[model samples]
Target: MMKNNISYIDKVRENILDHLKTYQHSETIYNASKYSIEAGGKGLRPLLLFTALEALDTDIEKGISAASAIEMIHTYSLIHDDLPAMDNDDLRRGKPTNHIVFGEAAAILAGDNLLNESFNVIAKDKNLSAEVRIKLVETISNRSGQSGMISGQMLDIEAENRKTSLEELESIHAYKTGALIKAPVLSACIIAQAAPEISERLEKFSEVIGVLFQIKDDILDLEGNPELTGKNTGSDAKKGKVTYISELGLNGAKEALAKKVSEANSILNSLDELISTAGLRKIVQMFAERDQ
Candidate 1:
């Protein structure tokens, strides 16, 4: 099963690269964009989309374009996030950040290019129905737009250097990180045309896992090995950013992470009778225990 999952991820990467080939009209912009996209991150969002599709008993192939689109948006966010004006990191995925290699201006444009092309990819996909494609575009835009990820980002920027309550931290991540995490799963449901009840349950499951993701990230930032994570540890604390570890303490954050993992498993159990939960259950475990 793990090997199959890896193969699926490879397919997603290949599809993303194939789509990027068409955008090479400008060499600099293309290289900047491709450099970040090819960076060796886990590609979790697209993996979640594929997992959800598999559980829905839909052909994962049908989700390839949508998966690539989600990954492009994710890569774009990382490029912008690593800029001097933002998180300002020197390394990402074990190499120099896009802005460090490409000029800041080019990196910014690369991010913009990826963001714009993501919607076009969905809109022009021939495999999905017009209605499905429209819905995918709408869902992605809303989740990654002002009311979702961007709003969360604004909240995070505002909270910096200030003591944030648990509620405030959760609210910030729910928008910034959780919103995009939810997007891919919801996109899968839309593509699968699953039953309304099933989709609703999966939506709740996605919410739990989204928070789980951020909590684990907080722990990893503090405790993970830089060699494995491909980024410096303690950068969050250096930035005075409020994370689960900072707010709840290290042990407290681990406890919270454990509870979320349990909640995710319970949700998967509820869906066992309706669809194959094996893949999603593995994903939940991966989210809970990943070192990078």
Candidate 2:
């Protein structure tokens, strides 16, 4: 199942890249956007989107545009996050960041271009109905906009250099990291036209995994290999940013991760009678045990 999931992820990455190539008429903007989009991070958002569709017994191809759009937004966030005004990181996915390779101005434009183009891609998708497209746009916008990821980012920046309570840290990440993560899964639910009961269960599952993803990331930042993670470990600590590991201690954080993982699996188990949850179960394990 893991190998199959990897195969699906590869297919999704290729589809997104092919879709992105349609905007290659420009020189600098196109190159900068392509560079970051093609960077070597795992296409987790798209994969989750596809996997959710599979779990719902929907054709994964039905979600191609949405998956691409979400990835573009995610890549845009990373590009802006690495800028001097933000995290100021020099490396991303084991290579020079967009700003480092393309200069700050071009990189900023590249991020902007991706953000704008993401909406266009969804709005113009001919495969989905007008109503579905509109819902997709609305969902992505709400999740990635101020009410979701961006608000979380602001909270994170504010909390830096200070001790944050566990509740505060979770709330911050529930937006920063968890929002985008939830976007893909929720997008999948929308695409599948999942029944209300099933959608509610999956939403709950997404929420658990969203927090689980962050907890695992916090653990990785402290103990992961830079070669595999494609960025500096311990950089969070160096930046004096609060994290799950900081608030809960290393073992405490791991315990929280285990609890979330179990919760996620239980949610999936509940859905087993309604849908084939094999793929989602694999995703839970991947989130819990990924090295990077």
Candidate 3:
């Protein structure tokens, strides 16, 4: 059964990749965007989007476009994040950074292209209700806008090489990392037109997963291999950025990570829903043990 779910997810990824191939209207930007998407991550956001939708008994067709849109937004962020102005990274997902291969200018354009196309992907989907699509788009804009992911990035940049309080650090991650992680769960809720009470529960559940994702990431960066993890490690320490490990200490951060994962599972178990939560449980375990 788990193997079936994994195959299902792989098929979804192939669908996503195939759909990306159709965006060839602009030769350069299209190629660049495709390149970034092809240079894979775990495809966690889209998986979460669909998985949550399934768990909520939402129509998967109506949610697939939104899932693709979420993946696009994530890819765009990665391109910009590896830019010379940001992390200045030379490698991503075990390949040369987008900017490095395409040149910084084209990579920037590619990121912008993905960001805009994300909206188009959602808007053009005829399966989802216009109202739900509108809400999804609005949510994406707000979550990715100045008040959300971008704000977190700005705060993180400001916090670099400085002593930051635990509260401040959490604020940075909640916006920067948590917003995207939360986006899919929220997107699923929107597709389902779930009651406010149910959406609120999933929101809290996703929040725990999002921060745990980052906390585990911080631990991995400190302890993971550049070869296996697909990029340089020790970047946090090198950049003098404060992370969960920095704020809570290694053992302390591990404790916190475990606690959050436990909390997320408790919420998932408590949710009023049907269909197997086996997929989500597997994803959580992956995050907890991911090498990359």
Candidate 4:
């Protein structure tokens, strides 16, 4: 990845963390939410939105609240995903999970709080117009709610101890994982008021990247360094969750990841004249090759 693009993504992640802390209130639940947000992650969703907005020649400032909100939503999902009723994980980002420190109920409340606060952040941001804010809320809700992330999650739960066809597996990821990823890309387009054709292309690019994200995660689970990923490996196999690696094997998954990276690059290159693509191209490389 290019140094500039890496620096840009890091800068955005730092700013989101700062925003999360700044908006935190004086309450125990707030502390729980803050703890999860500060636990640290790729912050890739928010970063993608901001970078896409930049590429679209829009004001990055207008996307900040949305970006931060997306990160909060992502963190909230992770918190819930680690609960006893769910993945039953005790670690996240190499730290005690929310439920481990706070009670399970409190952790659930914290996740709920974060999900609500994410909308509050978006709805309250004065920088964006009402039209833009409304669209942002709609996209986030539709994508992260029952129809998107939730759907994928439910499918994942159902897939446990059962064989899933490749198409079914893709459906699970597209919803559970791809929906949120698509939101940021679409949000940028909305805030930018991009043309229909441009928006369509970017949407397709987002979908590819979204699945690639999951594929890479699967590969990482199989071979990634725990020190870097901050999570244990082989949980998918242990849990009998269907993943790209499980279906395609290591070499096959890597090949698919490479193909998606190429597809993403092609999409971005085509849009370079419309938006500077250096940032996104670098991101594609990073995602395809990331060890964590």
TM-scores of all models?
Answer: 0.98, 0.96, 0.93, 0.93
Best by lDDT: 1
For each candidate, what is the lDDT?
0.90, 0.89, 0.83, 0.86
Give candidate 1 regions above 4 Å deviation. none
Scored by TM-score, the top model is 1
- Write the residue-wise lDDT of candidate 2 on 146-263 in tens digits: 9999999999999999877889999999999998998988999898999999999998898899999999999999999988998888989998889998899999999999999889
Clashes within 3 Å, all models in order: 0, 0, 0, 1
Q: Estimate the TM-score for candidate 4.
A: 0.93
Q: Residue by residue across 175-212, what tens digits does model 4's lDDT show?
A: 99999999999999999999998999999999999999
Query: Who is ahead in lDDT, 1 or 4?
Result: 1
Error of 2 at 135 (Å): 0.5
- Runs of candidate 4 with Cα error greater than 4 angstroms are 1-26
Ranking by lDDT: 1, 2, 4, 3
lDDT of 1 by residue, 158-271 (tens): 999998899999999999999999998999999999999899999999999999999999999998999899999999999989899889999999999999999999988898
- What TM-score does candidate 1 get on C-alpha atoms? 0.98
Q: Extract clashing residue pairs from model 1.
A: none
Candidate 3, residue 278: the lDDT equals: 68
Model 4 has an lDDT value of 0.86
- lDDT (Cα) of model 2: 0.89
